[model samples]
Target: MCGILAVFGCSDNSQAKRARIVELSRRLRHRGPDWSGLHCHEDCYLAHQRLAIVDPASGDQPLYNQDKTVVVTVNGEIYNHKELRAQLKSHTFRTGSDCEVIAHLYEEHGENFVGMLDGMFSFVLLDTRDKSFIAARDAIGITPLYIGWGLDEMKALSDDCERFTYLLPGHIYSSKQGGLRRWYNPTWYSEQIPSTPYDPLVLRGAFEKAVIKRLMTDVPFGVLLSGGLDSSLVAAVASRHLADAEAACQWGSQLHTFCIGLKGSPDTKAAREVADYLGTRHHEFHFTIQEGIDALEEAPNKEEFHQETCQKIKALHLYDCLRANKSTSAWGVEARVPFLDKEFINIAMSIDPEWKMIRPDLGRIEKWILRNAFDDEKNPYLPKHILYRQKEQFSDGVGYSWIDGLKDHANKQVTDSMLMNASFVYPENTPTTKEAYYYRTIFEKFFPKNAARSTVPGGPSVACSTAKAVEWDASWSKNLDPSGRAALGVHAAAYEETGNTEAANLMNGSPQKRLEMLDENCNSCLIEDIVASASCGWHMFVALWEKLLTTKEGNWLHKQNEIVPYKFVFLFSKTFLKGNIKYL
Candidate 1:
């Protein structure tokens, strides 16, 4: 993954404009820490913060076509680049970058080539000959891209966040046409309900293919195992294929799985079981409630089980995809989500909606189709109980106390009167709870502009469902908790029940082996501060610096701050952290 920023139709091509663009692009340095590149054409600018994953040595950005007329800056992986490169045999090749195919493809096929490319990408291609430019995102919108108008860099890129909105997935913006057009038109996108009979083997094959394609990375990569069906299935498939796959031959066949939670949390325990079963090298990180609170500044539902699924898939770029990209990119780690792969989504969506529905009478649970596909008895992918385990959102799974701790901290910080008056303070998407109010205050402190706040989505949602899907159950409408427990009745264990009978037996068998904790001096805990500081960037560090320095934990964080790369500290310390933060 990389960071891309493009500005076109600017009237000014001055040194000041170029410097400003570089400065703003540096804000995303955390996303792509390896290198930076910039391409300029008169008043237009395209900037890239490169996180080298494919052909790291030679694949630098601002890639150009044979004649150097077509230039492009990209942020994503093109899994089919090798095939695409084969087709462009006549064109003289440049770097071995997977994204290098983009400039050449645009030169060969004009703007219609987006559909031909099979990958998760967001790129801006400049046709220097005519000064016509096109910006496009992958079909599923797995990569993040935003668009804005005018040359006023501040308003175009930052202040007027309302105008600078997300570029629609499966669509492209053309400077010549001066508008947006949908480039992705798959069969499932049509309104007709798919009637194809469910086929488990076909579904399994498609998902496996998706997982394999994403393994095309040069750097060390691991799976984020939440111990849920989605992540677990991904790990199982990747693990099965690793031994013979090309990446494994280089990175090794031992699959590494990672999980983070309070020591005895459900997710931690569940992940341990799966890792042991799969024989993966598992790394589990434990965080205290206090540390989680210190990092506060840094940081669903089905179909009707079909109709809602369609809407949810279309809207993923806004929520799930965005969060996944930002959270992982903060630490210079690129996350590949196979579930969002275009082909896999199409196959999954093509199935009849009826099969997807939660049918207690049929003994099918949520995502039962997926669970059953990997339920191979002869060559078991995972233990049966783990395969059918109940779903838990990260908040609940990452230790139930994690959420409660945040709520408790918020309650102490945000009084009842403050919650009561939240509507006036927030006004747009008014905070409905003290926790919401507390976070909103911190958000506004950093991003005070009205336009910035408007970018956030709000409204009544049940268990992370869309406001429209809240109609699934009447009880859901009563309590707007965005928790899996609120979904009720759907799971083998209902909202009232803490654990399923079959799953409970697995947990009871083992008092999970505890990983060693950090020593009394908290030397290792500095990694947490580095991650938090990296995730939030300099502005957030400045906001928290004074408060952090006043506490015992703050001293530890200060020690961490001292050791982080000089670039981060150099950028903000003298300007803001050295007692001038009041101006901010």
Candidate 2:
């Protein structure tokens, strides 16, 4: 990743204006510390901070076309730049930077060129001839771009307190229209459900192609292996590609895999197993519990998970690209992710969503299709146990002690009175717990502006479940922490009780009989009740109480007002009657 900042349509042309641009851009220097470049057209200013992943020698930004009419500063890798270059042969060559193609592509195709490129990027292009500019972000927001106006008034652009926004992913903004517009719409976003049948071969092939495309880098590159399914599959595919004759000649050695955790943590042990199996040179980095707590105090946690797979996919800019790039680029290394590859995403999304669910009776775990696709008996990709390991949130994987330490530190720092008055202190998204309060206090110190505060998401997010997923189980809405462990009991009970019964019956009964039993037992009972039973045994009490409250003589409500205990009436109506009626 690189840092990009540009100001267009500003009338100020003084050297002071140039210095101010550089000064503001410097705040993002940590993203790209290798080199810096600036371009000052008649009324536009563009600055770039280069990380030098692709062309180390001459890839400094503010790249231009043959006549210099078109200029661009980009922050990301273009995996298909070679293929794009082949299509635009008429354009004169410049440097070997994967981003240089953006300049020429804009000149030929204008803003429409964004759809032609396949990679993660956020870029700004200026057309000096027309004095028009366009800025765009990638499809899935793999890169970050903030769109804000000058706080100080600009004669050509805006007055004070102009509306500032984060550029929407898969969209573009233009000076000509002065508004944002979508550029990367796909059919899947439609309301109609997809009808494509699942084919394991097509699924596997697409993923392999995706992994292979990301291998197009000149510098040393590696995968971030968490030993979970997604990262493990990425490491497996990358390792196979690295051993190929053409890839071996290009990269010149075996792949290097990396994992970080506290000593004796599950992630550490699992990652070690995966590295040994893949036969790659792996590096395991450990941090003390205190060190992790300190880092959490400084950066806080911003991890997100897929509700369906229960797998953690770190949100793009804040966590993956910016954080991962900064850590690795310090050692002159670039990290590539096969899971985020464009082709891979489309293919994966095209398959029926039902196949992604965890069906424990069939020994199908979360990400079951992916695990089974790579489960080769003749030449296995990974050990059976490693392939079936449960998902763990990255922060928890570091060590449970790390989170416990944060809670302890927060409890000490925040008084009960402060927690009671949390809304008044920071009303926008008031902190509910002491830990949240501590992190928010630190966040406000660095970003005092309202726009900055609004960028961070608020409200409940258990195990990184999407807002819609709260409907999956009623109790999920009550969860305050987003840790994976919070959902462990629910997962274990659902699979263990029902799954074990079905497996046992399979030995003595027909497959059809097993299916019928599973539907009758699992579907009729609400999943929330199943989880509630596992967690508190509350479902048993509720069921027994409901049975006692009912009678064949009259409506349950007629007897509820007189004979039933008040607490029993309330519980019965709420749990059994759907809270529609209340007994006096």
What are the per-residue Cα lDDT tens digits for candidate 2 across 1-584?
Answer: 66788887677889888887787666556456677899999878888877666676788888999999898989888888989999998998689999999999988887788989898788988899988889988876666676774211011121222445467667888888988898877654442334467677777887787777777654445566667666777777778877662436754557666566556666667888999999877766665444433333320011111223222222333333333333322222344545666676666655655665555677766667777777788877788887767665555554444444445556767889999999999999898987677667655544566766655556555554445554466667666654445544643312111222322343211121211111223311122222211111112222222232343312322333342121110000011110100000
Scored by Cα lDDT, where does model 1 land?
Answer: 0.66
Cα deviation of 31, candidate 1, in Å: 0.9
Model 2 misplaced stretches (Cα beyond 4 Å): 149-163, 245-247, 299-335, 488-584
Model 2 residue 200 lDDT score: 71
Query: On residues 30-73, what C-alpha lDDT tens digit does candidate 1 reach at each position?
Result: 66778899989897888888888788788988899988889898
| Clashing residue pairs found in predicted model 1 | 303-306
lDDT, residue 562, model 1: 38
Q: How many residue pairs clash in each candidate?
A: 1, 0
